[model samples]
Target: MSLDTPERLPASLADYQALAQANLSPDVAAYFLRGAGAEQTLRANAEDLAALRPWPRACKDLRGGSTACAVLGLSLDAPLLVAPMAYLPLLDPAGEAGVAAAATAQGVGMVLSAQSAQPMDHVRAEGSNCGWMQLYWLGGRDATMQLAQRAARAGFSALVLTVDAPVHGIRDAELSAGFALPPGLRAVNLDGLAQPQFAPLTSGESLLFDRVAHVLPGWEDVAWLCRNAPLPVLLKGILHPDDARQAVQAGAAGVIVSNHGGRVLDGAPSSISALPAVVAAVGGAVPVLMDGGIRRGVDVFRALALGADAVLIGRPVCHGLAVAGALGASHVLRLLLDELEVTMALTGCRTLSDITRDCLGPSPF
Candidate 1:
């Protein structure tokens, strides 16, 4: 069901987290909760959010206040979109539909994972028409083009090319939970590949790179992929400003400044910390978005004020879905949106447009 006749959602973002935590199972909680290895970047994501203190001002108009912004020609009611996550069936049966409904209720976009259990068409039909599809680029050139065409036909407006994960991350938690993708819910778009593979994680001394080196995309491959996609292409898993500049130069319409939420790489820098430099590289020529430690609307506020045209959320929404279906997911989104509105009002920013660089103090990083 959709959240059409909503009677105001949760007051605080933490309330959603608490409610969701109670509803989720052990595996679901761990999968959404843990980062790779030590979670240095995961912890740092929150710390960095706190660093961007909002410098208060004498409010001109607090009454006419809300948080809404436009990114990459898509007008989102908030400067946030649901991040692309795989296999929601593991958490809730509704899967992509639940996420789409939740995002729809919030009047924002949802990035549908290529690794989703549901087909692109089913998920596409769930929410508003702004759903984006993230592609992993299997079967090389011809197959990639076919998949992109399918996404466009399925009603997705944008293409999020995941460049970071040539293979899967070093997910110890998934391994321990015996988190294998069961037969019932394989990637619908990638049904009959001979050898489906995620990126090979580099071992400390295990020289297995040669075997899987063919899977990962170099800058040249990125350039080629960007040229082929019909929709606006946004490169995900971007960290360095140089890479951000490279992405834009390679014809990437946008870049998501993410370290895969510290999931793929063990000790990479936090996504939030990388935002400023990457935003500088893009020069706002293209929309620069990010994901990774967005639990609160204040985090949402922090991301946008720090030059991020938009932000993507990964864990919190998943947590909500795990707990309840569309209900929990909608609740989580409502909490964030509500808090963001309150934050804008208190900070003297009348609307999302008023939340500029000047509203923020020094980045503590």
Candidate 2:
């Protein structure tokens, strides 16, 4: 499948995934597509969403429908954003810059990854709608703050602190594939910053518990970043309802209900299954966003029905990038948005506000 021209683009998001599977190197595919442990949670993310059914409304006035919405003060064409993914250069030489351009051209938001292969300023310059920067606590507050300050100076509108997976997950597929970044491709945004160091492990000590855990960010760190960072901060990778409440109390601007796209904990519940609880916990105090297993426009509608202010997509965009650089990425968003509009029309929803829980029927799960 040569996806060199726009005319050759796939018709649906699933097709894009197939194209990506056919196109990407096996190592890259395994790294990007697989999840942690037995992949129980990975499969659940999509399967749970598939179990849900949307109740179609018949013969209602369908006029002036629009998917436009606001999140963290940024107006978006659709309640959609490209979730951050690292080292896009592996898929195409254009890399994060290409994804940024696609997001900007589509009038959707994008969150630049902390491990981006392209410089923050270069991506920002390429994407006017690129408003958020996703951050991982780089061992401590000061080192992490430096990245936050850099993002602010580059014109990003928000900071998304990924609080889950203080360490990398046990990804069996990635290990089997021997995934390693190709030569010359690196996290350009992290340049010049000192990497985190830990005391040498001693015999009979757990490496993760004795050494790595010492540098993990806690509630205090979250509060400090919220209070001191240059931009509004939103905590990503939250699943517990209590954590959602804690994030708000810590002065976070918002909360993203995610399970690290089911890549962190194999048995964790799907993002959709946990969303209503988190939303209830938030109690309208802040915006609630979601990610994981959002492959169709109907999934977006399903999320909004359950109380997600917006949704982000990770693998689908990467699949598109792997297929045809910026064009494939942009086409993927277009297909989803177009499908969202059609779904809205069929469900008798004229606006985003019209999508409520009543629009949903019983889920098989």
**Tens digit per residue, CA lDDT, model 2, 1-365:** 45667676688999999989988788999889889999999889898888778899999898777899888888999999999888998998878889999998998999999999999999988887888999988888888999999999999999999988877788999999899988888888888876667776666658758677777888988999999999999999999999999999999999999998878888999999999999999999999999999999999999999999999998999988998888889889999999999999999999999999999987655
Candidate 2: residue 342 lDDT (0-100): 93
Residue pairs of candidate 2 with colliding backbone atoms: none
The local lDDT score (0 to 100) that residue 336 gets in candidate 2 is 91
List per-candidate RMSD values in Å.
Answer: 3.2, 1.5
In model 1, the Cα lDDT at residue 204 comes to: 50
Candidate 2: segments with Cα more than 4 A from true spot: 1-7, 198-205
**Candidate 1 displacement at residue 283 in angstroms:** 1.2
Clashing pairs in 1: 166-199, 167-198, 167-199, 168-199
- Give the Cα lDDT of each candidate: 0.78, 0.91
